[model samples]
Target: MRDSFHHRLDVLVLQLARMCDLTAVAMSRATDSLATGDARLAEGVVADDVIVNQTRTRIEQDAQTLLALQSPVARDLRVIVTVLRSAEHVERMGDLAHHVALAVLRRHPDPVLPAPLRSRFQLMGSIAVRMAGTTGKVVRERDPVLVRTLDAADAEMNELHRSLFQVIGHRWAFGIPAAVDASLLSRYYERFADHAVAVAARTAFIETGTPALI
Candidate 1:
């Protein structure tokens, strides 16, 4: 019985890690769709979001079952609880990617980003994707040190996000519509990084018992 219960716990952790991987792929493809205005890729990213959502649901269900049946305490309880919270953050990351893809679809043949702002948004997306990849490792290993790296990544993303406003406010001649779209898209990438950071923070809390605000 103990062995079977332990196996279930392992499965939950693995599922959470796998979910992170899925979100990373989503973000990458979404980024590509945004940069190139690929409607088909954008649609695919939007469709795959259901899979990400389903993964989160499965993780939550399995973790809850373990909580009820195994009566886990101490580190085991910490792992399960943190897994649920991490799953939430990771899933949100997926949603942000989906939002980015939807923006691409909304714009259709017209490019979503202006010429000046395209590189910035692309960099932000890259940071988000990197954070998601690292988050998977953190989820599986629960390493506090690895979480710190994600923290650094989130900071970079924030800087890039702020830079987007600088362009739109002064230099942008793309008019209000384009500016608004850029602002929202920048927010999406920023939030994507934020969610990745939050997931890593949860992994850190598993070890250090620190509650991260972001």
Candidate 2:
């Protein structure tokens, strides 16, 4: 029974990694759609969200089942709890990516970001993708040192998010509509990074038993 429980735990980790993989793909295509005015890629991300949502549901159910059946205590219990919470964080990352895609669809023929803000958004998207990829690895390995890098990357992402406001501030030539779109897109990237950080923090918690400030 103990070996069976451990096997299920390993399976849970793999499932979480799969969900992270989906999020990374969603965010990557979302940025591409945002950058190139490609409505098709944006639509594809929106369609893929159903899978993300389903994965989250499955993860949560499996965690609950393990809790009921295994009656795990101490470290084993912590691992299951972290898996449950991290799944929600990953699901939110997917939703943030979906929101970015929706913005692209809304402005289909027209590009959502102004010329001045395009490069900034691209960087933010890159950071988001990197953070998400790292998050998946952290979930699998639970390496404390590996998780700390996510904190550094998230700080960089926050700075980029802050800098975007300067461009979108007063003396804006693109008008109100563009400003709104840029603001929302910047926020999406920021929150996407935040969720990635949250998942990493949860992975850290599994081993350290210390909750992260994030």
Candidate 3:
């Protein structure tokens, strides 16, 4: 019974890792769709979000079952609890990515980002992708070192987010609609990175018993 419980716990972790990978890919593709104005790619991100949601539900149910049946103690208990919270963050990341893609889908042939801001949005997307990748690594490895690195990555995201505001502050040629879109785009990416950082922080807490400062 003990071995069975451990095996189930390992499976739960694997499921969480899989969810991270899916979320990361969704963000990458959503960003690409945004940059290129590809409706098909944007649709793909929207469709795949169902999978992310289902996975989150499964993880939650499994965690609850483990708690009821196995009554995990100590680190095992921490792992189950952390997985529940991390899954929530990961799912939210997917939703944010979906919103980015939805903007592209709404605009269709027209680019969501104005020409002047395309490069900025591209950089924001790149940073978001990197953060998502780092999140997956943190989940799988649970290395405290990698967890600490999320702070630096999140800082870069903040800087990029602020730059978007600066672009909007000056007399913008893109007008109010474009400015609104740009603001929404920036928020989506920023929130995406924030969730990734949260996942890393949760992993750090699980491993070290010290909560991340955020």
Candidate 4:
């Protein structure tokens, strides 16, 4: 009986980790659509959000069910809580992806980004996607060292985001539209990476026997 219960619990955790990976991929697609002005890709991203929402709901339900049925203790309890929190992170990541798609749709086929600004935005998005993938890996493997490595990569994204803002402030010569759009895209990428880092930190805590602040 004990073994079966833990087996189910591990399956649930793995499912949530997979959901996080799917959301990260969706976010990457959304950013690509934005950078390339690919209307088809943007539309595809918007359409695929249904899967993200459904997966999040199912993961939450599973977490609740496990908690109620098993009355888990210690590490089991921590795993349940981590699964719940990770679901939220994955759902929010999907929302960010949709927002990026909407930004692309809003701009339509027109070149929505300035050359220099788009270049920087692309760099930021790439880093954010990579960090998100790392977060998923950390959760799946329960590796504290891998999580810490992701944390470092996340710091680089933060620096890039800050530098992007500085460039926007100084590049007044590019006019208001350029600065505003660049700022919006940078904000999205920054928030995405921040959430990824949070996931990594939380997963690290769960795996390493560290206390969760939540």
Ranking by TM-score: 2, 3, 1, 4
The CA-based lDDT of model 4 is what? Answer: 0.79
**Runs off by more than 4 Å, candidate 1:** none
lDDT of 1 by residue, 123-178 (tens): 88888888899999998887878888887888898888897778777866888989
Relative to the true structure, candidate 2 reaches a TM of: 0.96
lDDT by residue (16-121, candidate 3, tens digit) is 8889889889988998998899999999999999999999999999999999988788889988988988899999999999999999999889988888888888
User: Which is better, 3 or 4, measured by lDDT?
Assistant: 3
Better of 1 and 2 by lDDT: 2
Least accurate 10 contiguous residues by lDDT in model 1: 205-214
What TM-score does model 4 achieve against the real structure?
Answer: 0.92
Q: Which candidate, 1 or 4, has the higher TM-score? A: 1
**What does the lDDT read for residue 158 in candidate 2?**
89
Q: How close to the true structure is residue 199 of candidate 3, measured as C-alpha lDDT?
A: 86
Tell me how far the alpha carbon of residue 114 in candidate 3 is from the true structure, in angstroms, after superposition: 0.8
For each candidate, give its TM-score against the true structure. 0.95, 0.96, 0.96, 0.92
lDDT of 4 by residue, 79-194 (tens): 88888887887778878888888888888877567766676777777787787788788888878777778767778878887887677676357777757777777777778877
